[model samples]
Target: MTPVPGDNPTPRPAADAPGAPAPGTAQPAAAGGPLRTGRPKPWHVLWLLLLLGWTVSAADRSVTGPVVTWMIDNGVGFMAHADHPHALGGLIGGLFFAGYMLTQFPGGYLGDRYGHRTMVVVSLLWAGLATILTGFLGGLIAFIVVRVATGLGEGAFYSNDRTLITDNTPPKDRSFGMGVCISGLAIGITIATIFTPNFIDFGRSVLSDIEAWRMAFWVLGAATLVVSLAVTWFFRTHLKAATVGKAALHLGAYAVVSLALIMAVYLIGDSTGLSDLWIAVLEVALAVGLVLFVLVRKGEEVGPVLKDRDLFIIYLCNIAILWNLWFFSFWSVSIVAGAAHSSFAASALTAGFNAGAGIIGFPAGGWLSDYGLRRGWGRKEMMLTFTGVQAVLTVAFAWYLSAADHPSLWVMGLLLFFASLFFNALQPVGHALTAELARPDLRGSAFGMQNLIGETGAVLAPAVGGALRDSTGGWTAAVWLDAGLVVVGFVLLAQVRGRRAVSPV
Candidate 1:
């Protein structure tokens, strides 16, 4: 096949080549001075800091599932009188992602127009405040409000964080840095799964049953606030601060619009007694309209990012991935416990194995992608291979859980670990491909568009899984559905023809 104009026709130099600097080796100064060595590069610090940000984000969200499950089990809080406990619990998660999804494109657009550094700090602060409020507010409506607010704040994080890593790291190390940075997600999940129930037990010592779970939110939120301060201080010199402009004001407008739409939907649902599923559909439909308005107004500048057919396929692909992700994230503990017939604590520990695998899987996938790059493999090849393998592993896991009367906890854990290894690894590869597909100036928009469409899966998976579980009277159907989505993602990703490499910005 003929190389496209401006495509890099040759493979990257082998590691032994002088042109290919080893990861962490200093490059010659842009001014052509001696190579600076021994000291850590700026991207290293950013990677560490951003990883912490992801850690906090993951922990905060991960706590919700276990907390809701506890509420249902003990007949306390919102789950006390819930007619459909599973669906209501899933709706809580779905609502958060509804707010989260609405902000994806706007947040990235703001980060692009203003500054990624500033947007990152802002996101952390907003999320922290909203999380703390959730603990303090303590009722059904207030709880929903705070979680949605938290989602709004965190929605900005992905696009900006992706930009920061890609902008700072060299081509060879780019995916690795993304992998390392996002590995915090695994760390945070492990923390939540392993420790959150313990935290609730601690809360039980001093607090009423109704209030005990609030302790988890208070602690996690406080940690997020502390991390925000550290990130602001550490990132001061590492990246440019956001430029203040009229464009920055739009961020607030986006937040207001999202909150209003969510509340409006909830109120309509309450008055008319609409189902949670219908409420979710209304929320997504309105959000889509908002997105279309934003894109049409900004079409001249963002047209390329919006129009790219390959990127659209990737966007659809991510829907399947995130559906698998949040299905597990929001419901994994319950799934594990039901399948294994274990205690809540044991199930959480077992589920942590799945989340924990990403710590290694992310970086390993990134390294392998880079290796494949040097060997002349396309990024599409690396991504699709991982996707297909993950689909198979997911199906195996689903079948094992459904078929076994009492599946071995260890076996279930191993299946989850390997399935997630491939699942998590493909993320950074996909992100790196996104960076390559758009120009530097438009990368934020490209990533924003990718996630904006992709996160619908996050929005739908929890509620749908829950509704299915309620209808089927077992987790078997939900688990199979999750497995099927992974297969769909594999097929969608295979249709992508993009093979653009990241050129020097």
Candidate 2:
């Protein structure tokens, strides 16, 4: 396999060739300690940027929930007078997943085909714009459209994030870098959980009750846009040599995917007035089309390394795990608010308390993974252990919700803390495993496929959870369903045989 852009070292000219430095004369390093190519320090900066990016990404995506809360109360529902707000909330949440779902495979392929930096820049910019737009849109249809656009950009992001991790870190320390950096996802959620309501409250002082949600979007989106531009400048300025080609082919493939999406829209049947069934079918088509588009391409063929049967099982496991992650991330506040009989603002803060658990979990998981790998203890075992703990906590939380008259808010918050602790840890382990299992050439695609599958579940879980709550008028089924997903993921993860650690790429 030809070395991909991010991981590949620059080829040097022959000693006798033109532009070669004289035998004794040495060149100066970049002002910032060293040239970025092949250096570790620049990655520290990039990791910090990733930290920021992940935080903003999580905050941007979580906006759906806080905004939906306001919409439900303030009569900003799907219709002028909408009913079954939970179901509708699910649809809105699912729409973001729908848009997010399609981009995974293509995004990864693009990163593999082009440069990871390019994808990162584009994702941040797109998400920034979409996040801002989501607040401004009033109608459910318009809201869904903007959220999906946001998803598209965000979908591009995760795969590339891992790719950048894979490119920058030596194999031994990959889990550390990926886990610690991607922990920003949790931190962002925490920030949103704690501050989203506050933003709304501040907005209410100056704006209408309904318009308060718009304020959250405006501030978060504006900040994201500024960060995106800064990231773009830093990458472009430092890595000045990157060139773009393959534009024509990339565009052609995109056209094919777009056509497939349109065809799926018609064939899958009309949306039946924004019903869940309609969106599910449409999203499925887009997902299937993306799968085909990615898998069917020439030279894009994956080798046996990627074809490991265990890989798909792991992907399925990730999907199951992500179902838990997304559902909770999207709706935990609502669940807490209902069960604890607390205010939305208060419950959001309580629910977000779990996010703080990640500050420890992420770094610890990465360190543990690296420790295991270095000692030949294997990354999969460590991943499975954390995931198993997550499954148990998931069940415990579900049980408490069902058994207790009013699940103690403190107990619920504590359970959520542990659940998220183990859950967040599982992610970097999975990423490290992917980095280990996948050939460098296929790393981006592997991550894309993993996220694609995971997000498919992520897209549906919120809607399913919400619909279940709407139908049952209780969160028992919804919370238990999350537990069931964890068990399923745990079982699949257990099936993944730990492979011996490979040398750093």
Give the least accurate 10-residue stretch of model 1, judged by summed lDDT. 1-10
- Once fitted onto the true fold, the runs of candidate 1 whose alpha carbons sit more than 4 angstroms away are 1-37, 237-249, 500-505
Best by TM-score: 1
Candidate achieving the largest lDDT: 1
Q: Against the true structure, what is each candidate's TM-score?
A: 0.91, 0.87
TM-score of 2: 0.87
CA lDDT, every model vs. true structure: 0.80, 0.73
Give one digit per residue, the lDDT tens place, for model 2 in 62-160. 878767765665675453365678777876787678777777777777877666667777788878988888777777656766677677778888887
Tens-digit per-residue lDDT, 1-505, candidate 1: 2211111123333221223432222332321223257745555666888999999988888889889877877899878998889888888898998888888888888877666777788888788888878888778888998899889888988898987777656677788888998999889888888888988988889898678998888888999999988987765542343343343356768888888888899788878998777777777787678668877898888888878888888988988988888889888898888777789899999999889989998888888877777777888889999999999999999899778888999999999999999999998899888888876777778888888888888888888888888888889999998999899889888889978453322
Q: What shift in Å separates residue 26 of candidate 1 from its native position after superposition?
A: 16
Candidate 2, superposed: residue stretches over 4 Å from native: 1-40, 77-80, 238-274, 298-300, 303-306, 502-505
